[model samples]
Target: MSDTFFAYLVTLAYGDKETPTLAQVVFLSENEAEDTRTVARALLQNAKQTAPEKTRFDWSTLKVHGSQSLSDDELMGLVAAAAQGQVGVGRVSTLKLS
Candidate 1:
């Protein structure tokens, strides 16, 4: 059987701080996650390495159905908390794991 999965593309903005702020969130199916992740990471890398600005861009890929999955709402809430510096990456809690 082919298992289905949900993918979230979370954009972040870092401005003179160690913690990045949430910029946007986009939902996609598993099929599109890899391609989108590749492009997004490439762009993020380019911006970090080539851009001469103080602001930095990055992204987090959340796959909602695996060992590292989180509920949609929970993930969003944690993202907001992270923006406020209340949490850090890999600190988002989850209730289900498979």
Candidate 2:
């Protein structure tokens, strides 16, 4: 999908970090999408690199917005509380656009 066709805004915070990292994934805009994906992957890797030997962080699919133009605060909420877990993507949202 094109980044313009599908854009994602993700706000993530480390478990202990005071501030968070915000990334925008744009499928149409390969560059931006690649950038965000890279950051996400890097962050995931960083967390894994620091994780204790017997622990693991589950991979999850998070949605912070729809095709239109709005942000998913719920997804951000989950990310804010990011534990050694993943987001429940099964909850397909039909949320109203803002």
Candidate 3:
């Protein structure tokens, strides 16, 4: 059996003030989570290049939410059930095997 793990999708934003104006998060595979973070950082850098001269990019934040664990078979079953309208979005959750 494959070892189970947790992955989180984090959104980072920049702003001049102490407070952040935007935030979002999601669950993904471990590799996907890292890829998402890398992409966000690159996008932020690109924005700074074209942003106004005085734009202050001072604050960055990351938030994680939602947790569940499912094996490959469990995930497939969930997908199949959704196709048949036997389950809804509320039933979707992470799956981890000990």
Name the best candidate (by TM-score): 1
- Candidate ranking (TM-score, best to worst): 1, 3, 2
Q: Cα lDDT of all candidates, in order?
A: 0.39, 0.34, 0.34
Q: Candidate 2 on 1-98: residue-level lDDT in tens?
A: 33232233344433324433332221122233334344455344434465333222222433233332224665454544433433221211112224
lDDT tens per residue, model 1, 21-67: 43443333334334433434433433335432322222244443333
TM-scores of the models, in the order given: 0.26, 0.22, 0.25
lDDT (0-100) at residue 81 of candidate 3? 42
lDDT of 1: 0.39
lDDT of candidate 3 over 1-98, digit per residue (tens): 33433444334332323653233334333332235434343334433453333222222222212233445675444334424433212111333424
Query: Lowest-scoring 10 consecutive residues by lDDT in candidate 1?
Result: 88-97
Error of 2 at 74 (Å): 18
Question: Which ranges of candidate 1 are over 4 A from the true structure?
Answer: 1-60, 63-66, 89-98
Candidate 3 TM-score versus the reference: 0.25
